[model samples]
Target: MRILYVITPSRLSGAERMLLRMARVQQRHGDSVRVLSKPLDAFERAAADDGIEMVTGAIGGKLNLRACPTIVEHIQRFAPDVVLTMHSTGTLWGVRAARKAGVPCVALMQAANTRWPYTTAPAAVGCAEFVRQHLIAGGMSPDRVYAIPNGIEPEPYLDDEDRDRARSDLGLTPSDLAVGTLAHFTPRKAHSDLLDAAAIVTRSVPELVLLWAGEGPLETKLRQQAARLGLADRVRFLGYRTDAPRLHRAFDIFALPSLLEGLPLAVLEAMASARPCVVTAVSGNPELVDDGVTGYLVPRRNPQVMAQALIRLATNDEARRTMGLAGRKRIMEMFTLDGLMQRLREVLEREIRRQRGPGG
Candidate 1:
């Protein structure tokens, strides 16, 4: 099978990271997979390391015509069995280009709360059923939409020695109740809310520290907010670190207080790392974290509720351990990379076979 993935980013984000993983898996399974994206960055370099052919194409301001011909040329040259478009804004141009080249296109709707104006396409794939239903309700045929969630490849957990090494490298002591979050500094991610919740947690648990990873436009503003709330010491804004999984191992607990999410990969990584989780109740988070079972789910954007939940996990070692074990079990059971890639390959192969039919 031949697959072409279309994404708008040159930098590494959750979606791009997923794309890189998927490309490597599909390539491993004897599928010829490549990517059509902007300039080569760290994300593209990672994809290239995975043997995914990268074609440079830039799309600016949603409907940039600069890359239209390049996209059309790639489609005509490669003649892929499936073209999977990631991100809603880029889907229209990608779908149209694929249609013009007489190829099948699948749009991946990755957002949780934002209702993007989707374009008509052969099929639409969403990371969560919530986004799938929203797309279908907005005039997309039910038969043309699928709910294929995000996934990751999990390895064995780092031993206590390695965990300690990571902590030492990050300047975290074993005594600190470290709660970390890996998310971009955006309003949708609600980093300020997490900071506020951390302040509340500090009042109760003075040994607690919060690590906020990833960078975005709101970094300076968030730093100011942290200082204003007197949380500058407890909250560490550890810019965008590529070694996120290692960071996950260093945390005693993971928190994601996002206002909205479409099954965050960071939460999945935290679960895979056997760390207890506390995430806001929104989008596919409830489906992932089994609230009181695998992890705690507080109300979205409510720092006080989040703080209370964090206290529960931080103070109670037994509860934290139990929930963390449960979360790891759930990730191994439901969100492994092999299972997700198999489903994706099934979708691509089925579409290709149907498109070819049984005739000449």
Candidate 2:
């Protein structure tokens, strides 16, 4: 199968990473995969590093009528079996171009509560069930939307020596309890709530440090909040780490207090690294966390509740280890990279067959 993926991405976020993963898995499975996006950035560089062929085009603005011809030209040149689009802008233009070129198109919804730009595509994939319902509620047909959660390769995250080295490099002692998160420091991610909870957690566990990895628009503001709450010494901002998978080993508990999510890849990475999570109870979070079984789920913006949950995991080492094990078990059973690729392969093949007819 020949697959073409179109995306309009500015940074290396979860969705962009998923796109690369999809291309890699497809290529490994004997499928010809290619990616088309704007001028090279981290996404293109990473894809290139993986030996995937990437094509750059000007996919500007919301509708980008000018880009439609370019997209159609690429579709003609590559002659892919199916085109998969990620993000709103890419979906809008890719769907239009696919229709113009007479090729099958599929859109993957990466966030919750999104307004899908095109309704004519044969099918749309949501990263989680909540995301699918959100698309359906927003006027897309339920039959056209399917939920396919993100998955990860557990081998890279299974290194104990790398974990210990990361802990030592971060000045985190074996006796110290560390709560960590790897998310862009944006408002919707609720880094402020985590800072508030960090202050509260430090009042009880003085050795409790908040290790944050990632940079965004809200980095300076969050740093100020940490300072204002007298957590300047307790909160360590790692800032846009490339080695985040290894850094997961330094954390005693992984937490994400986002206002919303569509099956965050970071949480899954943490679970794959055998760490218990304390994430906000919104969107696809509940689906991943079993609330006291795999991890704790706290309400959004509730720092008090989040802090209490963090303290529970911090104080009891046995319970933390147990939950971490359960979380890894869940990922192995349901969310492995092989499972996600197989499902996506089936979806793309079915769509292509439907578009080409039985004998074509």
Candidate 3:
């Protein structure tokens, strides 16, 4: 099968990273996959490495009518079996272009909290059921939306030697109760909430240290916030890490106090690494982390409740180990990369077959 992916990414975050992984898998299965996106160096490099063609173009602003013709040209040239549009700009213009070129299009809605222009999209695949419901509520037909939660390859169970080495590399002492979070330092990610929670938790669990990874616009502001919250020494702002597995290995516990998410790949990576997660009960997080079973689920933007969860886990070695083991088991059994991709391929084929009705 030939697939064309349309997206305009400013950075290589969760959605872009997941999409690239999908592309790599498709290419491995001997399918022709091409991507139409803005010139993002990380994305381009990964695409080139995966043997996927990168079609660069500008898809800017809210209403991208100007980009539709460019997209149409790519559609006509590539002649893909289906076009999968991601992000708002891509879907808005890509759907139009796909229709113009007489090709099937499916919008990949990766978030549920933020509203995008998905109402007019013919067919769409949401990263989680929350996102699928978000689309249905936004006027898209329920029949047209499919939920295929994001997934990642489960990491092999780490030995004590591996965790120690990873921790030592990150300047973390084995004695420290390291709580790591991997996300862009943005308002939506709510890193401030984590910092505030860290302040409260450090009072109780002095050995606690917060490992905040990923880079974004709010870096400088977050650093200052850490200082003001009296958590400067307790928090490590490791900027822009591509080494997710190493980071996950180093973490005794993973936390994402974000206000929203659409099946965050960071949380999945942490779980796949056999680490327990503490995330806000919003969007797809609850679906992934089974509350008290795999990890704790606190209310959004509540530092006190988040801090309580962190403190509870930090003091209990048995709970952490049990939850971590359970989390990894869940990832392997339910959220493997291969399983999710098969679902995605099914959706693309289903749409293609529909477009070519009555056995064509």
Residue 215, candidate 2: alpha-carbon lDDT: 90
For every model in order, what is the number of clashing pairs?
0, 0, 0
What is residue 30's positional error in candidate 3, in angstroms? 1.9
- Residue pairs of candidate 1 with colliding backbone atoms: none
Clashing pairs in 3: none
lDDT of 2 by residue, 122-160 (tens): 688888898888888888888777888889988877766
Candidate 1: which stretches are off by over 4 Å?
113-119, 156-161, 354-360
- Give lDDT tens digits, candidate 1, residues 1-360: 888887777357888888888888888878888788877478667876777788866753366776556678888888898888877545767887887887877887777554454538778778888878878778888877788888888784534458888888888988998999998887898888888888888887999988888999999999999899898888888988988778988899999988888888999999989898999888888878998998999998799999999999889999988999999999999988888888877776666666556751
Question: Candidate 3 residues 1-360, lDDT tens each?
Answer: 989999988888888888888988998898999999977898888778767789899875566567999898998899999999888888888888898888888999889855567667779899999999988888888888999999897754444457788899889887899999999988999998888899899898999998988889999999999899888888898988877888888999999998889999988888878788999999988889999989999999899999999999999999999999999889989999999999998988888888767764
The TM-score, computed over Cα atoms with residue i paired to residue i, of candidate 1 is 0.95
Poorest stretch of ten by lDDT in candidate 2: 113-122
**CA deviation > 4 Å runs, candidate 2:** 118-120, 357-360
Better candidate by TM-score, 1 or 2: 2
